[model samples]
Each structure stands twice: as C-alpha cells, then as structure tokens.
Target chain A: MNFLSFGHYHHDMCLVLHRSLQLDNNSMLSFTLAMRDGQAFDTVLSRAKSMGLAVREGRLLASAKPVARAFSIQDPDRHWIEIILEN
Target chain B: MSNSAFIPPNVLPPLLQKFAPLLKRKWFRELVLLWPTLTRRRFSNKTEDYGVFKPSLVGHFGQLAVYVQDIARSRIWYQKVAGLTHSRTSDPEPHPSKPGWTLRACYMSAKEHDECLVLLEERDPSGKMSVPSGMSFFHFALEVEGNRKEDVFAFAAQQKRDGFHLNYGPVQHNSEPPDGDGETGGNVACYLYDPDWHNVEFCGAMDTIENYRARYGDKKGSDRN
Candidate 1:
C-alpha cells in the first residue's frame, strides 16, 4: 500500500492494497537487500527463519526468483524481503 | 489555470482519466503550492536524516512492482515515455488473482541499478484486469537523469515530442523553507499515466527526501526493511 526506501523515502514505490486483499494489488512488490561479499546468504536466510520469518527458495509469489544466490522471506508485514549476493 | 490544465478534455485515452483525479487532490497541490499562502498548506512530516551506520539491511533501494495489462506493451511504452529499458523477466506463472489465467512480468530500469520498475501482466479474456480498482498502486516517483529543473523540462519536452503526454507537471515544487521565505528550494516533479492507467512520476531535485532525513534521522530504525 505504501513504500519506504533505505536510500531515501520519496515513495519510490507504491501498491494499492485492495479491499479484497487479493494478491493482485501488490504494488510495492519486493525490497532487495544485498549482502556484503562473502557473507554467506544462507546465514542470513537461516537467521530469518529463526526470527519467525518464512524464508525459502522458490518461484512462488513470496519466494525469491532464480536470481543467483538469492532467497526470499515472507516477513510479518507480508512484503517479500529478498536477499541476494552483491555481484 | 484553465480546466484543460487539470483534465485534458477527455480527448485522451481512458488511462488519462485515471490520472486526472490524482491531480485534483490537495496533497499534490501542497507539494507544488509554494508558500506565501493563498490558503493553508499541508506539509509531509517525513524527515530524512541518516547516519553512516551500516544497517542490517545493507543494500541499495530496489525497484517497485506494478501490475499492468500487458508486459510487452508496457515495456515499449516505458521506453518511449520515460526512457526506461526492459531488463529481464521472471517466468510466467498462474494468475495470483484470477483462477483461470496465467501471468507474466518483467523489469524496467533507467540504468543498470539494483532497482527496477516491474510490470506484471496477466492474460485476460475479457481484455481487462477485472481487479476492482484499475490499479492497486497509486503512483511511484523515479529520480530523473539530472535531478535538476532543466532536466525535468527536457524530459517532459521529449515525452511530448515522442507523443507520450505528461498528465501533469514538469513544474518545480518545494517545501516551505525553514526561514519560511518560500524560496522555491524543493524537488522538480511531473506526473504521467501508464497505458494501464496507473499514475507514474519522473521527478528531479529529490532533495526533499534528504531534507526530511536531515530533520528526522532514521526514527523508525530496525522496523524498516
């Protein structure tokens, strides 16, 4: 429905959260966090699950795409938090 | 300030209609409505102060997700209108909303940055998304190439030349100055409508965010992603 960015908060993104709450209205789709080089993405993924987040690898809506060394977590806010290796 | 300045005679496509009402809202006017107040103005309390600390989420801001009626068509439109390029696409999958349809999506970026403007589309037999309100997302702003007022006008000029109408602006906007002199020191912004009727903005002079952060450094803290 609303988006906040680390670089700054100009609402770089927005998605309308419809009354039906259908997955269709997801606009501010995904926020990517690039880990420092050599920071095993698995460690982050593992820790995410420990924090009660559902972190996983797959092509599902909330899951990460097949981007290299990337994973996705369905955070409590229901936004897709994607972790990817810095190229 | 003719009526045509607000809504262009309905001569344009239906998508322009989607963008028209957004222009009428007071929030938009407040941003561009530089002080000296003919009437009261609303200011966004969002301050933008930040420290050099490495956050747990240590990555650049990424792209935004937008749903469209057609990915391929939308890609070309972004190119002509905003100069964004089609970068990559994810595999086509089942419609997350419609049971019988399949959907495909792609990313559009102005440069090779970590972020992108994603356009998601589904095959609709009805030629419409059928998703209640036309688009769930209201609008998103992208920093223009130069982040200057000239750049904003040049981009708007090019859009017009390319036949992509800017629903609003290319106008300079600023926040009320700390001294309250209304010196016009704010971001320059403009608004447009995508083919799918979603409002999109190409803005320059984005220091308003920095101004916000300076006044209010990362207050929400770890709660942010």
Candidate 2:
C-alpha cells in the first residue's frame, strides 16, 4: 500500500481522516478552518462559487449580535464544513 | 469557550465525597484490585478517566486510527482524494487477542504536521476478519490553509476524476444561539467519505475561542455547551 503524507501544511497540527465499513451519518459532524482575515475568507468563497460549488452564506450570532460572517458546504459524505471570518 | 466547562461541578454526593479521598489512595486501590470480580465492578462504575494520572496537555489534535478492509485500496483512495503522503508500513504481527491471526498497519501523514492517519488491517486471507461497523465513532477533519485555494481545488478535481464527489458544503456553520450559551464563532468547510465510508472534512477558515470571546464578549462566548 502506498502512503501519502500531507505533513507540510502546519507545524503543530495534523488532520486525521478515518473510514469505517458502515456509514454512520452522525459519526463525524463537521470541522472548521479559521481564515487569516476577511479578504482571504471572501476570496475562498468567491472561488467556490466560480467552481460552481453550492455555497450557503450566513452570520453567526451570539446574544443576537452577529459575531462572525460565515458559509458552509457539504461533502460527498454529508459532513458539514464551515468556514468563517470574525467580524 | 469559557473555562467553566473544564471546571467540574460538585456532582458527588456528601456520603460518597467522604470516600473520594480514600479512592485515590494506592492502598485502597490495591485492596479493591485483590478481588477480581469486585475490581471489575468498581472500575466499571467509575468514568473511564477516573483515577488516571494526566500529564500537562498542549491540546493538540493528533493522529486518527481507522480500520479498513483493504489497506492497499484505502491507501490509494486517501492519497488520491485527500493528498496525504504515505509514511511507513509496519510488519505483520500476531494479533494480541486472536490466536493464529496477524495485524498490519500503514501510516500516512499530512504535509508538515507530525500527526498521522493510520490504516489497520487483519492479514487474513480467509477474509474472516471483522472491520468495525462505523458505529460509536465520529468523523475527523483536516485543516486546510486559507491560501491553499488552488490546493483545495486540485483535491476537488482529483475526486471528480476518481468518480468520487463532495458529500456537502463549502458552507458556513455557526455556534449555538445565545440561549444555549455555546461557543461563539463559525467556519467554512466541505466533507467527503473515504473508501471505507469514513467521513473526511476539509475546512478553509475557522475562529479561535479567543476570537469568539472577543466578538461576543467574555461572558457570552466563554460558556461552552
């Protein structure tokens, strides 16, 4: 078996992906990525749209105040991937 | 989120509270261990982390272990779809609990992170080895750098070429509402399943807990739900 390693992206963290024989939709809910700033966030969002990927935009609220601007997309496995930029 | 979640509340009743100190003593633990049946019952009644020593933690997300039907097939799938680099493969060894059985594992890591995803398989040609049914476990995620839009797009293209598809998202998600007092913040992400049907997530941007506190105020953001 060939092993592919993507260990160069970050120094302190590694993203681990797992697979089980049976599909338990609830096993993994979602994971998030913190953008460096709003510009980078908007750039990625725009790129996703250009690729024709379905994207949903919204605001993350706390105490009825919008705390962050965000968007989401689903993978083939039906897991939520949320991207956000702090306001 | 607030540090209050990490602080345990006074859940022990007064009667049991008195014995809590005794339970921590080595001698008392030894006494309980003397009776095998009682030892099992005693430990089972307690939480899994009870009485265990803990070292200072950096709170880093580490490796994930996945059981697969075919290590070779899964390895190729992960490499093509997730862009993980293959690190090493371990020699087959005897299964600890099963006689005449052997286990082999392959380790794969992301670009620069020390953490890895491990693939384990039973080296049985008879095909009687059991793979987990995907219950009792949730999905794991990989954090993509914000500037890696091309890389993310490349990954998506490869998946399409391989006849796989994104399960969902590139969508945004928020923390719980104020009434829930959950952590405040949000993220943009997408998801997919590996060959063995395990969910894999790739995310672009997320907020830190400190950022959450900054945006929502210390009190509202600190309380983790």
The best candidate in terms of lDDT: 1
Q: Across residues B1-225, which tens digit of lDDT does each residue of candidate 1 receive?
A: 011122212234667545544443445444454462445543333223334344334455454566665666778787877778777787866754356665566877777563366677655655455332333344566778877778987888888886676777665443332211121324676777776666677877654456755633555421221
Q: What is the lDDT of candidate 1?
A: 0.55
What DockQ does each prediction reach against the true complex? 0.32, 0.04
Q: Which tens-of-lDDT digit does each residue in B23-136 have in candidate 2?
A: 334455456546855545422221111111332122233345566667788788778766788887777766433467666667788886532576767645454654534442
User: Against the true structure, what is each candidate's TM-score?
Assistant: 0.60, 0.46
lDDT of 2: 0.49
Candidate 2 docking classification: incorrect
Error of 2 at B155 (Å): 5.0
Per-residue error (Å), model 1, residue A11: 7.4
Per-residue error (Å), model 1, residue A10: 7.5
